[model samples]
Target: MQRKKIAVIGIGSFGKLFVQYLFEDGHEVIAIDKDPVIIDSIKDSVTIAVALDATDEHALISQGIADVDYAVIALADDFETSIICAESLKKCGVKNIYARYQTPLQMKVLELLGIKDLFNPEERAARSMAETFSFSGMRSSFLLSDDYSVVEVTVPKRYINKTIAEADLRHKYNINVITIKRPITNKESKRASDSKGEKILGIPHGNTLLREDDVVVLFGSQSDITRFLES
Candidate 1:
C-alpha cells in the first residue's frame, strides 16, 4: 500500500488506536492532541505527536497539516472544538477530511463543511477492537498473551530470496510463519510478474520462497517477534 500522510486530531482511546493502526499500515501519521500526557503516550508510534490546539489554523498550517493527504478529527466529548478544528482544517486547504460526532447537531455541523465521512462512537470490547485493526497486518492485534502476539510483518532483508525452509523462522525466531501475503503474479511457469493486487499464499510450506515485498503473518511471543523483525 502507498504511504499516506495523515493528521489525527484527538488522542483519546479511539483516536490513539486510529493513529497506531495508520502508523502500523506504514502511513506517515501526525498525532495531534492538546494534552501533553496523551501526546507523550503516542509520540513513539507516530511521525509527529504534538500537543497543540487543533482549532488554531496558524498552528495547523505551521505543522504542515494542510499538506497531508487526509485529516481525522475525533474530539469525543467536544463537538464545539471539533467544529472549530474542521474550519481550521478547511482554511489549511485539507480536502479529504473525516470526523466523529456525538449528537445529531454535531453530525450536521461536520456535514456542512463538506465532510460526509462521519462516524459515531461505538462501544467496543477490547479484544474485538484489536481484531478489527489486525487485518491490515493487525491494525488490530492478536494478543495471545501479555508476552505473545500474532503479528503480520514484512520479510526481513536477510530472509529475502531464501526459502522458508532455509530461513528457518520457526527454529531461529521461535515464530510460526502461518501465511504469506504476496503480490499477485501472472502465471509463466511460476514467473512472478507484478500485478496490481496481492493475495495470501495460504499455508506456506518449507519450500515457499520469501520476497522483498512479502508480508509474513507469524505467531510468537512479543520479544521473539521483536527480535525477528529487528534482526
Candidate 2:
C-alpha cells in the first residue's frame, strides 16, 4: 500500500475510526482534538496525536498540516466547528479536504466553500436502510447520490443461466452489471473456511452467464434498480 500523509481534526467516534483506518492502511496519520483525554486515548494508534483547537489556522500551520496529502474534518453533530476547521485547513493550503456534516443544509454550506468530498454517515445509513426495507432482494445498497445507487442483489431465478446480452439490462431496466461474484467451493478446506466463499471475477463481458448463486453488482438510478430487482 502506498503511504499517505493524512491529518484528521476532531477526535470523535467517526474521527477515531478515520484515524484507525488510515493508520491500519500503513499511512501516516495526525490526530487532533481539543479534549486531552481523546487525544491521549488515540495517541499510540496514530503517528501523531495533538490536543489542539482545529479552528485555529496558526496552530494548524504550525503543525505542518499544509504538507499533508489529505485532511479530514470529522466534527460530529457540530456544523459550526466543522466550518471553522475546514476554513483553517483551507487557509493552511491543504489541497484535499473532506468534511463531515450533520444536515443537508450544512452540506450546502460546505459545497459553497469548495469542499468537494462530504460524508454524512447518518443520512447514508438511513437511506440504505430504507432501500433494504423497500426491496427484499437487495442484499446491500450504497447511495452514490440522491437518485443513484449501487446495489448487490441476488440473481432472480428467471434470469439464471441467461447471458448479459440476453437480459438487455441497460435498455429494459437502465442498469449495468459491474461485476459478478460467485461462491467457489474448496474441497481441500474445512467446514468453515474463510477463503471458501465468494470472490469477484473482475468486470464481466457481454456474454457472461448468470449462475443460480451468482451475486451481481448493479449500478443505476434508484427507480431503475427497483424496477430491475422487482422483476
Candidate 3:
C-alpha cells in the first residue's frame, strides 16, 4: 500500500479509530484534537498528535495540513466545528477531504460547501452488517454508489479449483473480480508472515486457480454481485 500523509481533525471515538487504522497501514497520520488528554493517549501511536482547535486555519497550516495528501473531518456530532474545520482545510489547500456527518442537515451543509465525500460511518456499518447477515458468503460489502458496490465474498464450493478464465464471471454474472485474497500456507521459514501470524497471497491473474477459503474482491452492481454470490 502507498503511504499517505493524512490529517485527521477532532480525535473523538470515531476519529481515533480512523487515525489508528491509517497509522497501522503505514501512513503518516497527524491526529488533532481539542483535549490534551486525548492527544496524549494517541500521540505515541501516530506520527503527530496535537491538541489544537481544528477551526484555526493558521494552526492547521502550521501542522503542515497543506502538504498532507488527504484530510478527514471527524467531528460528526459537532456540526459547526466540523464545517469550520473543513473550510479551514480547504483554504489551506488540502485536496481530498472526507467528513463524517451525523444528520441530514449537516450532510446538506457539507455538500453545499462542495465537500461531496461525506459519510455516516455508523449508518454504513449497520448497512454492511445487515448485508453480510443476509448473504451467507458475504464477509463485507461497500456500496460505492446507488447502483455499484464492492463486495468481499468467500469463494463458493462450486468455484473451487476453477481458474479465473473458466469461472466466466463477467459474462455469466456481470461481476468483475478485481483481486483474490488467498490464505497462505503456514510453513516455517516463510517470507510473508504477518504480524498476526497470518499471510495473504498476492493478487491473482487469469490463469490463477481459485481455491477454497479464498476471498475474492468483486466490483459490479449490487444485483449482479448478489447473483454471483448466490450462484
Candidate 4:
C-alpha cells in the first residue's frame, strides 16, 4: 500500500489513537493540538507535533499542514473549531478530509463544507457495546439504514451439509449471505490425512453446502435478522 502523509488536528483520546495507528502503520503523520501537554506527549511518535490552534488557517499553513494528503478533524467537544479546521483544509486543496461531530447540526455544517465522512465516536462506541451485550452469538453487526442491519452468524449444526438452493435462506429467512470465510490449509503437506482433513464450513453458492462451525455474514432487515435469530 502506498503510504500517504496524514494530519490529525486534535490530540484528544480518539485523535491520539488514530495518529498512533497511522504512525505505526508506516504513514507519515502530523499531530496538531492546542494543548502543549498533548503535543508533548506524542511528539516522539509522530513525524511532526505542532502545538497551535488548528482553527487558525494561517497557523495551520505555517505548520506545513497544507501539504498533507489527508486531514482528520477529531475535536469532538468544539464544533466550531472542527468546522474551521475542515473548511481551511478544504480551501487549501486537501482532497481527503474526515471529521468527528457531536450532533446533527455539526454534521450539517460539515456537510455544507463538502466534508462527506463524519463520525460520532460516542454513538459508535455505545452501539458497539449494546450489540455485544444483547447478542451473544453474533460476531459483528452494522446498521446500514433505519430499517436494515447486517450481521454475521455462525451456521448451526442442523444446517450442515445443505446446499444454498436447498437451504433457501432468502426465501425462508429473508436474508442474503454476502460472503463465507473458509480456512485454507497448506497443499504441499505429505500427509494424505491432512489434505482430506480440510472441511467445508459454509458454502455460499447456489449449489454450496452449509456445515457446522461455519460463519455466515448476511445482510437483511433488523426485523428479519431478529426473526431468523429467534428461530
The 0-to-1 C-alpha lDDT of every candidate, in the order given, reads: 0.83, 0.89, 0.86, 0.81
Q: Which candidate's lDDT is highest? A: 2
TM-score top scorer: 2
RMSD in Å for candidate 4, one decimal?
Answer: 5.7
lDDT tens string, model 4, 45-67? 89999999887888888877778
1 against 3, candidate with superior lDDT: 3
Give the poorly placed runs of model 3, Cα more than 4 Å off.
143-147, 183-199
* Candidate 3 residue-wise lDDT at 80: 86
Superior candidate under lDDT, 1 versus 2: 2
lDDT of 3 by residue, 122-167 (tens): 8877877888999888889998865788988888888899998899
How are the candidates ranked when ordered by TM-score, highest leading? 2, 3, 4, 1
Give candidate 1 misplaced runs (Cα > 4 Å): 123-231
- List of clashing residue pairs for candidate 3: none
Clashing pairs in 4: none
- Decide which is better by TM-score, 1 or 2: 2
TM-score for candidate 4, residues paired by index: 0.70
Kindly report the root-mean-square deviation of model 1 from the true structure over all alpha carbons: 14.7
Compare candidates 3 and 4 on TM-score and give the better one: 3
Ranking by lDDT: 2, 3, 1, 4
Q: Give the better candidate number (2 or 3) by TM-score.
A: 2
